[model samples]
Target chain A: MLKIEGLTAEIDGKQILKGLDLEVPAGEVHAIMGPNGAGKSTLSYVLSGREGYEITGGSVTFHGKDLLAMEPEERAASGLFLAFQYPVELPGVGNATFLRTALNAIRRQRGEPELDAMQFLKLARSRMKELSMPEDMLKRGVNVGFSGGEKKRNEVLQMALLNPSLAILDETDSGLDIDALKIVSEGVNALRGPGFSALVITHYQRLLNYIVPDRVHVLVNGRIAKSGGKELALELEAHGYAEVAA
Target chain B: MNAMTSNAEAFLRRAEALATPAWVGALRRQGVEALARSGLPNRRVEAYRYTDLTPVARAEFGAAPKALARPELPAQRGRARMVFVDGVLRADLSTLPPRPLSDAAPLLGTVENSATAPVAALNAALAEDGMFLDIPAGENAGLIELVSIVTEGAGPIAFHPRHVVRLGEGASVTILETCEGPDGVGYLHNPVFEVVVAEGATCAHTRIQREGQGAYFLSSIHARIAAGGTYDNFTLNAGAKLARNEIHSALEGPKAACHMNGAQLVGQGQLADTTTFLHHAAPDCASRQTYKSVLTGNGRGVFQGKILVAQVAQRTDGYQMNQALLLSEDAEMDAKPQLEIYADDVKCSHGATIGALDENQLFYLRSRGIPEKAARAMLVQAFLTEAVDGVADETCRAALDEAVMGWWQGVAA
Candidate 1:
């Protein structure tokens, strides 16, 4: 469902991702484990089409369409979602309002009828319940004062609402506690069916245990150095990144 | 000697020929004299430094003629609406409870004589008709809508409306005031409003100015809060080629509280200014001022606010904040926040921030699939929600919030 070949990108003329290549076929979940400065976040940001990242050379295709050529919102309309590592706090912007705008924009692009206020609230409240999120979060500003777990849960709630085909989780479990990790993992696992895919980026092996991946890849210095099954994550954790990377 | 000055002077001459009581004539004469002395506010003047009225100095605008139709602007329901057209109260289109009023001639002279801004003095001298409301003790007047409309006219004209509101002890009232003008007419709307909040009274006022693109608006508001009284004022300036909204509040009695909040949105050659002064005369009074401005396409926004704590006003707490969001690189914002505390025991703080819409916030919204234009508009509205939320009246706040959306739809394009 997602393809990246020789992805070379830089930020402010400083090279971050150099010739990184990875892929996640349809209906599969893959986990990318890497230590700090391993370009895990860079790869996710590049896939999401965030500005300030200069693509030196690369090609990213989603469902056979060129993803890099699309604008950020266009990519989103094309069913590409990125759960940011650190969610932004939008003061005065209610969480439901933000979600509705996004949902309507995508729905309009897809030639679907727009959801009114009541329809949106009903859909959002159910999804929020599935994620074990409180209803009041919908009334507050977008992640303005949310706790770490709440923020991560909000990201998952958005992912569920957008119902994207490909979601790139960028270090989403770094700040979450154990209970939050299980709920977030369940949220992701629930989306693991036909026509759905994800690239779970994480620094530790703890997250992979909850959302067991179909494949495990270790990224080192902006490139995939090793690819294995779920056991690889345990090996890397027990042996440490220094030993496995060397 | 200039055309603008002469035009203002000619307006007084016209008002003089159509005179009435002696007190009104004398007040008009003093206003004309004061305006002739000062002319239009120049950049050299301390209070008018950032805003330059020189650009419109050549164009001439005379006193407006009789209005033909009433303007229909958005208003919240269940409020008493008082309509005024070209400074003349339209009783045919107004809804007000029966309340006796003092002689307008004397009130006009009093406010005109004590006015500080020369333009206000000009309004007093040439003032024609206005609004008067007196709420007795312990009564809730609910929300009163004072809507002023400048109907389509043949030529450039000016109008001044002197509005006076008095709330007796323990009285409570909420006012939703709006002013609008014709789209293509060049005119001047100089209005003066005064409110007296008696001891233990609560008076909340919301003023909105959406003048025509070819018009100029200059207004002044003076509010006095007595012992244990509370005064809240918010103004939204969204139109006019040039506009200035000046507000002054004096807390005369102990334990009084006052809130001065404003929001301005200017685009292209439009200019909007909000200046406020809060005076704490008695002990243990608190005042807060928050003003927000959004400027784009070479528009200019000016904010000048000052808080004074008198010597005897010990334990005074005053806070002021002014923030601006510039959408275009050429847009400019000038903020001057001052605090003059004569009392030894006081807590005062003021801050100003000038910046573009946060890029990260924009990206966050867009990444969620909101188009760039819609995302930017949402962010701008959120930025302004700070001051709009300051409106204590829920229905009035909802009305203003909808107004912001309506404005964003037009201006964001």
Candidate 2:
């Protein structure tokens, strides 16, 4: 469902992704493991069409459409979802309102009928129950003063509402406790099917324990050094990044 | 004399020729004298430091400005309305409130004028007609609307409308004042509002100013609250070439509460200002002030607020905050917040913030499938709603919310 070739990108005149190539076929989950400054977050941002990044070379295709040429919102409308590394706090924008707007936008683009307030609330409440998030969280501003766990849960909530074709989880497990990690993994696992694909970006094998990946790609610098199965993550965990990187 | 002073004198002389009662005529004379003394405020005055009124003074308004046509006004339900066209009350279109105590008494010039508020004195002297609303003891007046409209006129003209609102003990009332005019007509609408909240009484005042692009709006509100009374006020300065809203509220009795909140949206070449003063003269009183501004193009906004706690006002709590959002590099915001506490037991604080839209927040919203323009409008509306919600009445709040949306649409256009 997603493909990239020679994806060379830079920020602030310095290259971050140098001719990197990757692919995630339909009905599979792939994990990208990299050390500090390995351009893990940069890859997510570039794929999401965030500003401040200059794409110098190569191309990216999602569902057979050129992703690089589209605006961020257009990319989203085309079923590209990026769970940010740091979800911003919108002090006055309510979570429910934000989610409803996003849902309606995509629904309109896909020619689907929009949901009214009652229908939307019913769907949101059901999803919140599955993720163990209380319904009151929807009334507050988007992640205004949420706890670390609450923020991660909120992201999963958005993912559940959006049901994108491809989901990019950018370190969704960094600050989460073990229980939160399990709950978040369950939320992702519930969405697993032939129609859905996800690229889990993490640095630790701990998260991999909860959401086992079909393919594990070890990234050294800007390029993927190796690709293997779940065992690869265990191997890297035993031996620090230095041994494998070399 | 200079051209501005001479012109002001000429306009005042023309006002004297209007058909007015003896007291009204005398008041117009006093207004002329006050303007003659001040000659229109300049930057030299500390109160007018950030906003210069020289342009308003220099404009060549017609000596005998008349209403060219009837003004268009929307009908709002659940509220008695009083319509004023070119500063003259239209009794044919007005519905006076129920159980009005001041209906038989003369309400004009009831609020004593002072040298400090020269503009208000001028408004009192020149006001063509005024509104007097009285809520009897223990009664609740659902909502009252005062609509002031200025139709398209030939040249620059000025009008003053005085309004007096009084509440008996344990009474409650909500008032919505809307001002609008045709574009390109240079009219100055100067209005003075006098409010008295008796013991255990409550009042909510919401003022919306959306004059013409070439219009000038200057408004003054003087509110005095008695023991166990509450006064809540909100203002939206969303239009006009130049507009200033000055509000002064004094807590005359113990345990009185006052809240002053406002939002301003200024577009190209527009200037809007909100100056407020909260006087805590009695003990155990509380006051709160919050204002927000959104500026684009060459728009400029100013907020000057002060809180004074008298020595006898022990256990006073006062809080003030002003925030500005600048959407363009050319837009500017000037904020000055001050607090004076004569009582050591008082708790008082003031804060101001001026910033552009958060780039991170913008990216987050856009990345969620929301368009850039939609995201911006959402953020601006949210910024203003933080203060707009302070209005107690839900219907009035919704009306203000719609006004903000209308302003956004105009900005987009």
Candidate 3:
């Protein structure tokens, strides 16, 4: 579903993600495990078409379309979603409005009919019920004054609504407790299908246990150095990134 | 004579021709004299530095034509509705006719000091007709809709409508006031409001100014609150080529409170200014002010807010915040927040923020599949929602929200 070749990116004068290559075929969930400052977040940001990052060289393609050539919104409309590590707080924007706007925008881009307000609320409520989220969460401002876990759950809720083909989970489990971790993992696992794929980016192996990945890749010094099965996560957890990376 | 002198003379001539009671004539004389002294305020005046009224001084305006047809009015939701056209109360269109100014002569020109307020002085000099509502003690007067429309005219016309709202002790009322003018007409709509909130009473006033693109709107509101009284005011300034909304709220007795909030949406070639002054004169009084401005194209926005606490006003609490979002690089915003405290035991804080839309927030929205234009509009609406939410009345809030949405659609187009 996604492919990258010699992807090199930088912010300002400093370089990050130096000539990294990776790929996730259709229906496979992959995990990118690395230590601090290992270009995990940069890779996710570069893939999502965030500004301020200069693409020095290389290319990324999603579903046979050049991802780097698209704008952020176009990237999103093309079924690329990035769950931000630190979800932004929109002070006065209600969560329901944001969700519906996003869903309708993508649906319009895909040549589908848009849902009305009542239709949207009904769909959102059932999704929230499955995720064990409160109905009041829709009434509040988007991520404004939300708890750490609540923000992550809100991200998962958005993922469920948008139903993207590929989602980049960027350290979404950092601030979540154990119970939240399971719910978020279950949310991701529920979306596991032949048409869905994800790049679960994390620093630790804690999230890997809940949402088991088909492949585990160790990213070190801006490059993916090793690839293995699920046992690789256990190895890294037992030994640590330093030993496993070497 | 100079342009300013001619402008003042024209209004003075109109004021002198009105055959009213001796006290009313004296008040008109005071107003004309005040205008003659100050003329049109320039940058030299500290209070009027950001806004220049030279256009008003240079223009020659005629009286309103009596045959002009009234435009459509907003849906009224209140105990009664009053419609005014060209500063003349349209008794045929009004369901509740206010008492004549001669009846409220004692309270008409007593709330504000017209000598220092040029626009209020101008309004006073040429003022003819407006609303005068007097709620009796302990009476709960429901919402009242006051609509002012400046009909299409042959030439540029100027009108000054004077209003008075006096709530007796323990009385309460909510006012939804709107001012609109015909497009392509270069008229002037200068209105003055004097409000008195008696002891233990509450008064909520929401104003919406949607003047024509060629119109000039200059409004002044002076309010006084007695002990245990609360005065809440909210304004939405969305239209007019040049507009200035000035408000002065004074908490006179102990435990009095005042709240002022407003939003201004200024587009190309438009200039909107909101200046406010809050005076905490009694002990344990409180006041809050929040204003937001969104400027696009070559629009300009100015905000000047000041809070003053007197020495006798111990334990006074006051807060003021003014924020602006500039959509274009050519757009400009000038914010000046001042706090003067003479009391030792007072809490007064003020803050101002002026900048473009936050990039992080914009990207967050865009990354969620919202188009760039839609994302920017959503962010701007979010920025303005904070101030609009301050209105206590839901109907008034809905009106403001509709106006805001209409403005956003215009801007987006």
Candidate 4:
């Protein structure tokens, strides 16, 4: 479902992704593990069409469409979702309004019917309950004063609601507690299907234990250095990325 | 200066010929003298630096039309209303008639200063008719609506309507004042309001200025709060080619409180200004001011707010914040917040922020599949929420919200 070939990129005149090649085919989740400066986040940002990154070389395509040529909203409408590491706070925009607006926008772009306020609330409540998020979360401003776990769960709720074909999870477990981790992992695990794909980027092998990827690749100096099955995550966890990458 | 002088001279001639009560006539003469001396304020004037009155001076406005059609009014949101067309009271459309300003002479010109506020002097000089409400002691007046509609005529028309609301001791009232007209009319609507909050009384005043595209809406408000009294004022400036809403509020007695908040949505070919002067004269008083401006498509917005705490006003608490959002590269905003304090023990703080919509926030919204335009509107609305939500009256707040929505739709179109 997704492909990247020699995806070299740079920010502010400094090369970050030297030469990266990776793929996550239809119905499977691929895990990318690396150390602090492995350019894991950079890869996700580049795929999501974020600004300030210059694609110096290589190409990326999603479902045979050149993803780099599309705007961020177009990417989202075309079934691309990026669960941010640090969610932004919108002080006065209600969480529900933001979700509904996003849902309807994607629906409109995809030539589908839009949900009204009441219908949206019903859908949001059911999703929130599944994620163990409080109903009051919908009434508050978008992630305003939300706790770390709450923010991660909110991201997961959005992922579930949008139901994207491919979601890039960037450090979703960084600040989450064990319970939150389990819930979040379950949320992602539930969406696992033949038509669903995801690129899980993380610095630790902890998240992989819950979602259990189909493939694990070690990213070092902006390129894939090693690829293996789910057992690779345990191997790296027992040893270290330095040994694994070498 | 010469052009302004001629303009004032013509108005003075018109006022001198009018037959009215002796006191009213004297007030008009003083207004004419003041306007003749200051001429219409230009860029040189400190208060008028950001808002030039050249357009008003250049246009030769005739007296308000005698016969005219009553424009469609907004849905009634107040218990009683007084409707004025071109500054002339339309008794046929008014549900509650007002007493003449003659009975409220002592309170009429007591609160506002004509020297600094030339528009107040202008209104005093030429105001033909206006609403005068006198709430009795301990009486609850509920909600009152003051509607002013400026209709187009054969030529540019100018009318200065004077309004006064005096609440007796322990009385309370809410006033929703709206000014609207058809689009693309170069008429002038200058209004002045004098509000007196007696001891232990409360008065909440809201003004929505949705004038026509080419109209000049210059308004002045003067309010005085007595001991244990409270005064709240909010203004929404959505329409008008050139608009200025100036307010002067004084907390005159111990434990008096005042709150002034406003939002200005200025679009292309529009200039909106909100200037306020707050005075904490007595001990243990408090005051708060928040003003928000959103400028789009080369529009201009100005906010000049000053707070003064006297030596006797010990323990005064004053806070002022003014923020602006520029949606286009050509849009501009000018904000000046001043604090003059003589009481060393008082607490006063003021802050100002002016910039484009935050890029990170914009990108975050767009990444969620929301279009760029809708995302921008949402951000702007969020930016304006604080000031608009400060309105204590539910009906007034709803009306302001509707007007903001209307303005947004207009901009989007």
Question: Residue A73 in model 4: shift from native, Å?
Answer: 1.9
lDDT of 1 by residue, B21-58 (tens): 66466666777777666666678778889976655444
Whole-model lDDT for model 4 versus the true structure?
0.89
DockQ of each: 0.83, 0.80, 0.85, 0.80
Give the per-residue Cα lDDT of candidate 2 at B205.
90
| Most accurate candidate by DockQ | 3
| CAPRI grade, predicted model 4 | high
Q: What is the lDDT of residue B117 in candidate 1?
A: 67
Q: CA lDDT of A29 in candidate 2?
A: 93
* Chain B superposition TM-score per model: 0.92, 0.92, 0.96, 0.96
| Cα lDDT for residue A185, candidate 4 | 98
Clashing pairs in 4: none
**Model 1: pairs clashing at backbone N, Cα or C within 3 Å:** B28-B125
Model 4, residue B329: C-alpha shift (Å): 0.9
* Interface C-alpha RMSD, model 4: 0.7
Error of 4 at A162 (Å): 1.1
Looking at candidate 1, what TM-score does chain B attain?
0.92
Model 1, which residues run further than 4 Å from truth? Answer: B1-20, B54-58, B66-78, B97-114
Cα deviation of B94 in candidate 1 (Å)?
1.9
